[model samples]
Target: MAMKMSLKLNSLQSIWYCVFVVVTHAYLIISAFYHYHRVRQMDWPDGTLPKPELGLYMLCVTAALLITVLFIPTQIFQVGNNANDRTKLGVEKGDQGPPKWKGGLKAKLVFVRRYTKHLGPVGATMHIVSAFCLLLPVMFLQAREIEHGLLPPQSIWRSEVSLVPVIEMDRAPSPPPLIDTDLMSTNQPDLKPHVKEPPYKVSMVTINYINYVTALVVYAILYGDVFWFCHKGFALLLSVQLMFNAIQYSLGFIGVSLLYKLHTYGWDKYGIPEPAVVSSAAGLVGLFLTNNITIFLSAVVMFLYGYTRMKESELRKRKNNVEDGKCSVVYKGNALRCQGYIPHMGALCVLVIFIICKSPLIVEYLRAFRHQGDPRLLACMLYDIFYIFFWAFLWVVFALKREWNFNFAYLDEVQSVKEESSQSAGSTGSLVNDNGMKNNIELSFVNRYNQDIHQRHNTDKVTEVKMSPKLHVANNMPVITQASEKYSPKRLRNGSATAEECQLLHQKQEHEPIQNGVLNTSMNGRPV
Candidate 1:
């Protein structure tokens, strides 16, 4: 079997890469937080500054990205470069394997052992920290929404706002002479009504909250193995989570980008609230856009971990005679059915949902809101087009090529059962005793029968047996004649013995003289 090799970062490389990721993410996190604070501080008198909790939510996701990034290196370090190398080296070197250190003060306590059994103390800590980091933004949003009701819906289209400014000469006040410059010109009609809030604030918040809750639940299962305890099962869950998170954020990113353009155009064209409003809002929007890039990069790291875990799981299952699509495996004492196409099908479902939710947003943004030849129009069109295409193509291709039916072989447990049955049969059917002495099966059976006969008979009866010099096989059957108690010759045929015959022979024992037949006896006084 070919060993699957995984690319591993050396210690120095991991350190350097981690340092770079940390430093860059640190800067971005600070920038995002600053922009979030700016948005929170914005003076919107009517509470129309879009989502109030977006800043805090972004901070939560950013923190999770950081921890997940740092966790990448630690997890990578735990994995060996070559799958088989560690096990082979372990056996050859008589190594006791990696040391299991009591993770922390809390993990060392007896009460904590149950929770930490599967993950171990250190792993449980990491999961708890990461899960909380991911959950923080969700709880915050839910609480904030409950405290302050959801924002009101905004217009999908402008009802009375003029597309072009109109100058009314009849209504304009007569200006003073040009020489009296103090009151120079008459006031002009407004170009368009100021758009105080985004058109999709309510929808955006609703979708964002949904995605947040879904992501939190998904990550909980993916990390803590809440639903599926098997490594491969959780790995599949993680992959699905990452894919869904990426797609959800991709949809959000496109929407945010369009909003940025729409807001910038409105601000520039109509001068709605002046550049002061633009600065804070633009900073927040820009922070969201950039933060998505960080998320994508972080997801790539997690995706690698998930992929590695899956491949290792497949390898392990194969070692235990469990193959994908052909057999299931015993995981956590339960049969877990697995196939290569299941996750792909899950990804496909996610893609379909993404299309359903995001397609209209993209169409509306491009066709209705964006002007012809807008700089961002082409880029957004290309991005969403290829984004959907990439996932659709990848998952569809994978799902179609792999088998859908599960064999339900349960190979692991089946193999174990076969081994146990073989062991029992060998132990019971063996011709050797427990003390390593060899004994003939037939001789032992006959000796047991003779002992029963001797116990049943108390009279002293002389029994004589003649030993034949050489026994010849006649018609492939060995026949021995023994004398009965009435001197009647009884024939003993080989390979034709049964429990009933043995019982009958014991019940009516007749050891008479050997008249015309000879019996060959061994030193134990039993016929061989």
Candidate 2:
């Protein structure tokens, strides 16, 4: 038989997924600083300096850092509350809570040890990755300062010495040819300095200094949140962080365009060194591409989380009002109908924006590749190529297979299984009926609704009823009174249900209630 599958990611899978994101982001950070430093070193022929425009790049890493920071707390909460002793250290739900400020050093250390023992791998990985992220900017700043020189050039003008033969003096007859070497030295022409190239003011050093410092401060604050194990606090912080990330990634395309324009300017006007252009472009592409993917994944995770929570909340609400079964059905249908698909829609929008921002960069880089083939460009292209597969995997594995309170299945697989079963049954006539009864089935909304209405209105005092599919419905209405007493839950449990009765049971399980009095059901019959 074809088995039902759910694509929801468990904790382990989610952690690994986030690890992929974190690794990519870390590379992006390293690449950004490396190339930014390289670009800063180039003294353009036109005296113009290239701008790395690290404002967005800084935020990009900051977003990644904050997300990692948030993840630590989430993990802490999950672990502390976990009942699985094998997965947790000594920490449990009521293990005297986290260390307080008034606690002694030993107490604090003991408290830290409990959580850290369980979270060591995850925390250590984050710290290692984030340390590079935090320190690279400062290194870039220092390198930029030392490279462009401790002080701006005193004079913008550069003078060149040229030796020109004193033809007029040579033509003039000398009084006498001195036998001494001093006479020959006297003929040496005086050197004259001519101003050839002038330097233009480059403010990139100051601009980057400010940018990197601000980024460092912002990143440090987020980093501090890592040790703070308050989920509620992180939730609030994440809202702001997410908003900032959204704005940055949304305008990331503009940053790319600007960087491209700067590179074009240098290449066209001054014939800037090719390596400089390539490095700058590579960094720009990698930064934005990776950053966009990171943010997109983050958005997907957030939406999926919210979607799961909404489902749980609804289920809780339904269970709490079990006595009002009809209200529960109506409430669930209306609520889900209105809001169930928001997460999918939101994720799709993020994906679309990600594509829009990254597509132009890919095309631009392709053109760059034609000009000069570099490993950096190849790396970017690889990211783009793999990103396509990643999107497919996410959609197919996470979105489509999700339990949306609607039947979603691999139709071909189901059909193949059904055909195989039928062929086997045909070869064994004695077991054919039993095989058919065991086959999975589904009920249509119309038939299910008829059955529900019939149950409510009929005077039958039966605790439960099961009937053969052939006798259950006629003319779109439930023929409940006609059902025989041969089928029951006990009989089905004992493996004695006939094919018709088993099919009816399967149909009953798949039945989804229609929204009554809220939505018009007149097309089916009349609103309940």
Which has the greatest lDDT?
2
**TM-scores for every candidate against the unseen true structure:** 0.33, 0.31
Which residue window of length 10 is worst by lDDT in model 2? 426-435
Pairing residues by index, what is the TM-score of model 2? 0.31
Please identify model 2 stretches exceeding 4 Å from their true place.
1-129, 135-139, 142-306, 309-339, 367-372, 396-528
420-469, model 1: which lDDT tens digit per residue? 43332210111111222222223222232233111111112224333211
lDDT of 2 at 6: 40
Per-model C-alpha lDDT, please?
Answer: 0.37, 0.39
lDDT value for candidate 2?
0.39
Deviation (Å) of 154 in candidate 1: 21
Per the 3 Å backbone cut-off, how many clashing residue pairs does candidate 2 have?
0
- In candidate 1, clashing pairs total 0
